[model samples]
Target: MINQLRVKQRDEYYSLEVESGSNLLDVLRRENYFIETPCGGRGVCGKCRVTVNGQTALACQTVIDRDMLVELQNEEKTDILMTGISVQGVLDGTHLYVMAFDIGTTTIVGYLMNGISGELLTQVSSLNPQKAYGADVISRIQYAITTDAEELRKMICGTLLELLNEAAKSVKIKTDEIALVSIVGNTAMHHLLLGIDVKSLITPPYMPKVYEAVELAMQKLFSEHTEGVVRILPNIAGFVGADTVGCLVATRFDHLKKMTLLIDIGTNGEMVLGNWQRRIACSTAAGPAFEGANIQCGMRGQKGAIDHVEVQDGKLVFHVIGGGVAKGFCGSGLLDLVASLLQIGEIDGSGRLMNGKEYRLSDTDVYLTQKDVREVQLAKAAIRAGIELLTKKIGISISKIEKVYLAGAFGNYMNPKSACLIGMIPICLLDRIEGIGNAAGEGAKLCALSKTEYEYSKILASETEFLELASLTEFQDVFVDSLKFTEENDEYL
Candidate 1:
């Protein structure tokens, strides 16, 4: 038996027919509706909400047993990080046009450049459709290993092709006019897009099957687009993949003589310390706390989400993203809120709430629970521990660092004061920190436009030392100690 399904979204009605007992989430996905399922449709994330027959319900848990009306929640326009520090490079002009992509776990951004002049013709961005499977890389890897990797591959590839089309269309050109493409992403994203098994990535010896640079015909990945060769940048390690390599290339980290630190805080924290002499890189499993995942009242950096919090006249004043009733806390807002709580003595050094298990925000239904503090602690500790261990291994104090480049959305938007107040970033280096928006994407553009930078990216992947923090015995002690919210200096006013 088949049931009639009507989906109402943004005042537009979409009609379809579905087999009886079919999962609403699956049906919606099959029809190309981008529904968020951070828990892979396991009903754990509570993100896949829809209206069924005039009643609000979880789409992932709903079964289409009868003809019904389904209304999908309208997706808000998220504030995606797109701009980056432009690097100077010589365009080889091998192709008339070229493109670059940064396949971030949360978002995918693409750039269209003039092949001859290296001019940025057009740029596009969209939420990674694979977030329908999971929000974090680990969950996506697990989904790929246990379920269908091909499905994930198709989802990403389809989106990439669409982005390419959108970019070309905006520039009033055909995608086939593009002659070359360069891409960068974390190892899991790299592997998944290439249809490689992710089981090894999650197992004991976590390593990608292919970490070397790859050049292939565009048609090999997408049969529809066969005009160019796609150049995938190399992956440095299991976690520190081509994205980090791209960041290094964008900042010219390998050529810098002054001691510098580069950090990209996201679902997983990837950081590199030192400069051209000896750069040590490590990845911390920071989880998705910074992305507003795994918290009691958490969400992505979307509308109605509290994205910033500050102490005003001894009162907590937070600004929502879209400026309305506060729904929940996003990463940056959560960090600032926690920092404000600590400053006001509501939260102690050990991450304990003074009043109760949950602390409700002033004039809002959103409550920051005790578990949320722990989640933040674990996330921050991992990053701080990596920073400490990396600096120590290089035999340099945090004060010796001359410049700190913070990459990614979270790193760019996060309050440096709050980050340091919670010990997520060393307070001594606060004065030197700079947010280079979307550095990885800039690296991809560099590689796409310059042959010299593309070749240099390979060198960066091979030369950077990968430090397995789990192998170090002192990591646990440092991480535990780093969990405490310590106010290192009173100078950050």
Candidate 2:
């Protein structure tokens, strides 16, 4: 295959052999270097940039060569911090630490926090490495089913190792110093991390192999360094993972007496409806339309990504996240743009882009193609239908929702009023809506910081009832009704 290479950082040097096609990132991680390659060996994010023969190149982008010499770049000189779960007062004078890992389908966020103070020390996030295979979990599952299973595992594990190393380095500790880690993710994501086959999730049965708490030693997961234990937050059902459990915990749903709903919108949209009496959960495959994927010109919320779009004086005005030139549209920007168009009668209730003529705004072409409308239609239909079905299942009306918490990265940037115009959300719940950014991460952090919270999550997972949307007979009718926009007497807009 290939020759051995030497990698040096600080005062230590390591030798390793790699195949010719292997990238430096893979080699370094294999050697337990804890290099963070958030883009899954892709050339994006630039987090894995390193010095190779005094030249700066993305570790994931460069291939290994014979007798190559490498050094850690200036950005890579941070010390590795020990992190993980811990029981209070178990170890002698060592500082207690825990890590919360939000394993999202699109991105992963890690929080290194003190187990006692509830203070966040360091946070690290990056695109999920599995993105190289596909953007969503379903695509990744399909790839795993047809292509390579072991490779998928390697990719996921490698990405996690990078995150673990980065968090450790940021906090100036070793891997062994960390005590415990709690992770939150959807069903497919949880399955992938545990190396469980997910083919059953996509077909008729729609069953998950496990929905309870899973515990494994860190060393068992990684060969090079694994000193602590990893606790996967218990999942609710087929689609709802520990992430939803975290959302419930973060929002204190159990403490509320009134009816409430938590909707975390993403590639797979999940909603939880409950109150003091009982809690029920369901999931819908909303696709990547909202995340700026599977569209003509879509991108994630990053530099130059259009975050807001509206029509002023029959001309399009858009705001980019970094206030730079518009490169492409993000989820929030797409949602606002689509909703604005609908409000102006440019798009009908059926989501047809009208105007019947060419239009140009500020040197940029502005036109919603039939396909774009259809995409928004599908995304909105899934989310709205989910909300309606859950509310009906609980025998409550839209007005009965006392609070609605929005979770996920995109939700943090969305305009609630605009979201209502397109009927993506009910207008009555607009005032009660609050964006809770990365509740999964927060829940993970709570688990890291408190043993009580970790145990509470286990209890919550068991007590929470999961309702499979696919199995519900009235689900199709609710979905069809939700597709039509409610125009009259809506105040949330």
Clashing pairs in 1: none
lDDT of 2 at 236: 83
| TM-score result, candidate 1 | 0.95
Candidate 1 lDDT (Cα, 0 to 1) = 0.90
Candidate 1 per-residue C-alpha lDDT over 3-69 given as tens digits, one digit per residue, 9 for 90 to 100: 9999899999988888999999989988889887777778876778788999989999999999999
For candidate 1, give the lDDT of residue 100: 96
* Model 1 segments more than 4 A misplaced: 1-4, 15-17, 53-56, 65-68, 487-493
Cα TM-score per model: 0.95, 0.80
Question: lDDT (CA) for every model shown?
Answer: 0.90, 0.73
For candidate 1, the per-residue lDDT at 278 reads 93
lDDT of 2 by residue, 338-382 (tens): 777766677777766677532222445434456766777788888
